[model samples]
Target: MKNEYTDHAWDERDPSPWLALYLDQSTPLPDEVKAAWLRDCSSSSRQFFLPLVRPMARVSMILIQLLKIFLPKRWSHSMLLHRLLALSMNRFVSPEANWLIMRHFHLGSQVLAFVAANAPVAVTATPLTPMVIDDVKDELFLRHDLNLFNFVIRLNKALRTENKELLPVPEPDFSMLRQPDLRLEDMPRGKLNLLDLQSAIEIYTPVYQLLLTDNDFWRASNSLQLDETVAIYCAKILASPEHLVLLNNKHPLVPMTTLYAAYRLVLHGLSSEMLHSLLMRMARGEIPVPARELAKMHKAAEAVAAEESLAP
Candidate 1:
């Protein structure tokens, strides 16, 4: 969760990058920003509007084209519209848009360090760090994973507490990872472009499904774990010797949580590199978990440590 977002828009750099972290994900967002994304998801809007987004966005798309015809090149972008576009893009646009929107956050051990290490201070509007990367390091996708991430954390806790046998994790095909379908240049940047506005309204951000052939038009078929090997990377990010101990599930009791975990993995098609690595380490006895009596105390300590580092 992020600190509460106040309504103060930045005058120099656009704040959409910062806003998207909150608005699109389960993380906390500015009250008003959340309201904008609530578009039709909000309860109040349901009674009067029979889904205003698809139709309204379509109409908005037409109006945007007309505005493009008349509006001068010098003054086409509106800050308000840009803000609204960022707010709406996550729900209304393509997964490319969500992928691109996620481009805002530059991942590193620390934001400034990442910027300094990769970004040059000169010959650039802003210094590009780590060789001027557009995408943040993959570990961040772990934290920005928000509630879905919490699900992972909780599942780990449950599995370990119950002393269940480790489930077999599915092998993910990372070769499938690729760039987004939409063009980055066509997107609305710091300055507004009609295409950007239209994209915000017209495109759809898919959740689980990628190929149109994979699912129906209305239902999305993909999740973050399945989307881009996000979970696998989160596992890699946490694949330290200490983390192996922290998440170890081999306790004294033998129970059904292991079976339940397997059920979840198969049910949702979880790509389980994380679980696999843990299982290997557990089999090796490479990292010792706390004693059964002290395990509860270790769990608390592990939770706190994760709060500060792994999952925070």
Candidate 2:
């Protein structure tokens, strides 16, 4: 993979480049090239807002933990405390970043799928060692924060079943944005599970679903060796080779950090694409916005007739 592709993956530098692209308009956006901008918007928003609500999410975490002591682990999440916590997220959190919060699950799933199909059989055939699971779990939690390792196990079961149970997404209205529901549908999380069984899965690499138990999938999770192995396993599976190609020809060293980068990237890319598309429609009289508004878009679209000329 090229440096341009990896340049944006784990860094804070703005991938938006809206000003540059808007002013220049020379950069071509071929289908595959968009991976460079494929940030899962919802996840980024959640992380960004996390600092604001961590105190509460922390409280929720503690309450959930306390319930685990008295009840089955399965029952812990159903406690009033947990329900309130999930509800608070919709109430207090900013509505801006709702792209795909469980993107890691989907990405992780694809990584497993790729490894199962492409890696040597010994890996996919073997169950992950119980001893090693502790190490991988801690590391994955540190990086991805999928609630907790226990929660991830549950999330995985939900994610891979015949009827996929994607981690819940907050349903804040994004009606002002272009076809926000469609954007949600466009996300690749749940769809990535058992990808071959369905239509095209939105991964950077070609992936095939492999029949394997949960243990087989978690081993490449890089027991205490996550850094060295992230790229070897993830390389081009989650982030694309042409876009967010991983460092050292590898992918995320810190998966959640990479996840955040992706979230911002996706949000910016979507906004840019939407703005450009709307400008084009307006310029073509397919929309009713004024010529001045078209001009305001930095001439990203062609000139159009005045608003009065656009008759119904």
TM-score for each candidate, following the candidate numbering: 0.22, 0.28
Off by over 4 Å in 1: 1-52, 56-100, 104-191, 194-202, 205-211, 214-312
Please state the error at residue 68 of candidate 2 in Å: 15
lDDT of 1 by residue, 154-266 (tens): 44465467765222222211221222233333432332222222223233222111112222211112222231232233333333223333222222122222112212222
- lDDT of all predictions, in order shown? 0.31, 0.30
Could you tell me the lDDT of residue 196 within candidate 2? 18
Candidate 1, residue 197: lDDT: 20
Alpha-carbon deviation at 33 in model 1, angstroms? 12
- Candidate 1 Cα deviation (angstroms), residue 63: 22
Clashing pairs in 2: 39-262, 39-266, 41-99, 42-98, 42-99, 42-100, 246-250
Where does candidate 2 have its weakest 10-residue lDDT segment? 197-206
On lDDT, the candidate that comes out on top is 1
